[model samples]
Target: MFAARRFSLYERAFGPVVTPITSIRGLLQDFTTTAAYDAAQRSRSNDDYFATIHHISNIVRRDIYMERTLNKMCISKIVNSELVYRVLRSCSRSGIESFRFFNWARTHHPHYDPTTLEFEELLKTLARTGHWETMWKVAHQMKVQNLPISSSIVSFIIEHYGKKDLVDQAVELFNRLKSFNCPQTTEVYNSLLFALCEVKNFQGAYALIRRMLRKGAVPDKKTYSILVNGWCSAGKMREAQEFLEEMSRKGFNPPVRGRDLLIDGLLNAGYLESAKGLVRKMTKEGFVPDVSTFNSLAEAICKSGEIDFCIDLFRDVCKLGLCPDVDTYKIIITAASKVGRIDDAFQILHRSIEEGLRPFPSLYAPILKALCRKGMFDDAFSFFSDMKLKGHPPNRPAYTMLIRMCTRGGRFVEAANYLVEMTELNLLPLSRNFDLVCDGLKNCGKHDLAKRIEQLEISLRGD
Candidate 1:
């Protein structure tokens, strides 16, 4: 988020409000703002400031009775919201300790006062550790301080409660949002639905959706996805379709089709077989699954070691107007390489590039591994060089893999050349790498190259 800046009197004036940046007044204000920004950046980088937060966190983490210890330290200045938030996050796992530290920061630390950010973070930390009572206490404090608990925070809390299976508490929070002056927006409703679905309370989730409809709040895509996912997880696909049809009948059409929602949900709930069956059926009908859902299905199927079936699905879907994304290519390429299908992997890589996607090291590293596995050293080296010169330069892991393979293949001179190449790229080969190349060179009777590798390590280490 952009930080808030202090407005100057001249800049705040009505005359300059309409003035362009070319004006003298505007230029002066810009310089002043820039200088303040620089000073703020320097303050943020100060080690002492961070060390202070760390020190306070250590004390808070040890015991919940932080006020007395923090008081004795006699902190000389007021802490801002960000500092307070950082310390609270540091003590987040210990809910009681975080609350105690927060109380001290707001009430005893000089002229400090907690803002919405500090209050929200404290509540989130408390919720994270299942401190239900203390979380409400903080919410009440926020309300009493005339701070409205934003709907976004309410949604987060509800989502956390759902993950913990505390559906009742989640419902309670949603019901009491009016007390906190937070409206029951779509976000809050969706969060409650998620919590209900987490507990397999789809009936309750459906009721909540009804309430949202009654309140005239439009159901967004996430709302539809959540309910559909719940039904699919419960093995109630028939009910899921009926629900979508009902929504459509009510003139509440989801942004996507019902088929995509069901397929994605099946994939998420670990029903790979069911998802695959639906995908095959859909493609058979010339109906395209959503690209995101297709990519997810492909990734999941590839992991099951049925790469051929997944590749067939990829082709079938693409023919049916499903455009594969980069993730789709990555999954296919990786699985192809894993199965020693280097030619297939190369074909997928080229297709990704033909689709105008930038080729990256990850997209080709597996091919290098496959080549090395097959002892095709020349092919691996050529591909690595092409990737560096024509595509994105290979990253450290790629270089390391190539180096290790070279040593094992008795290509000591080539390995030494790569060690030098790494230095040119400002990528440090690992200590183990230097040992591998040097040992291989010594055994192969290339002492001059071995000495060069050793010197390279020494120069880089500045020893």
Candidate 2:
């Protein structure tokens, strides 16, 4: 009997394995006879659950037949918590009739926590992948189905749609939460405030802030900062100042960065004296001007051609132990040159170099251009040569200026020599430079030299 049993087992093992189709049919037959199956079929009034079951069965692999069988029956009979969650996940994955599915899940599973790990993960995935419209639909469905929407879910929608500038949808969602008597938090207001500020919709932001305040939702430091900075950026410094005063009255000092922004806005809008007064007041109130603040003040002073005041401010900045950056020198040099004080510019340059401040090409470029424009070609060329010796070679603009200077001075040979030097440095002479040299030679009664230069140009072009 043992030998016969062994032979039978071996025969079955080596026989052709039954196909999945055959196994599925047998399982379906068994399911049809089970109590759960009978109850599910009897309870199927609408085709929604049945349709979802059919969709899921058709798509899922045959390997997990039992789980699918359970899922189908679960959807049809009782929309319990676990079963509803499965439907929600299935809806999320299938990307069809998600609203319907989510509504059904929420209505029947009202007691289920919306902040469950599973739901949060799914909502975040939908949000991050830019499925905001779908997420909006899902949130709406949840509300209609009388399920408690999670704050996290609302935050996700707010962040996503807000970033995309879907202001209407974001506001709708926010109102929905408010209608539900959900407590407003700083984070929620911040999200909406940021959305408004990002699009520069100050009116909307101001309205939103007031509304939140009326609802007993106090704005935090960050909230106040956003409004102050936003107003300043929109060139409404008076409004920003008003808000700052209000903040102070409310025992809240504005952030350093926000104050800096306010000061800059005031200065840019031609309120220099007001800005200086504010700086003094802020300093008295223990708000020292940072490097950026001093920098902006210096820039405004220079721009207004108040060089003497700017020089004094520069001294104060140095006294504050803040190392002068390249911009500091630029502002001083630019102002000096603008006011026809080339001597002052040269002195600043010398002092900057002596103080171990390496001159950037940008700094020298503008100064050189200014010098050349003032008919100070000798000084310009000297500066250029010094730059080269200091391992900071003059750029194409400097070389072009030199070419123009030599040609204008009726020194064609000097221009030609400079052109050769430029070529040896692998820099191409501009066509204007060539034209200028030709014109200079011809005007000096050196037509032969002009012709030779033109021939050189032609050869260079061909090569």
Top candidate on TM-score is: 1
In terms of lDDT, model 2 sits at: 0.66
lDDT of 2 at 236: 79
Residue 253 miss distance in model 2 (angstroms): 7.6
lDDT of 1 by residue, 360-412 (tens): 88888989988998999878877887777885898899899988988888877
- The residue-level lDDT of candidate 1 at 392 comes to 85
Model 1 misplaced regions, further than 4 Å: 1-45, 63-75
Clashing pairs in 1: none
Report clash pairs, candidate 2.
Answer: none
Error of 2 at 156 (Å): 15
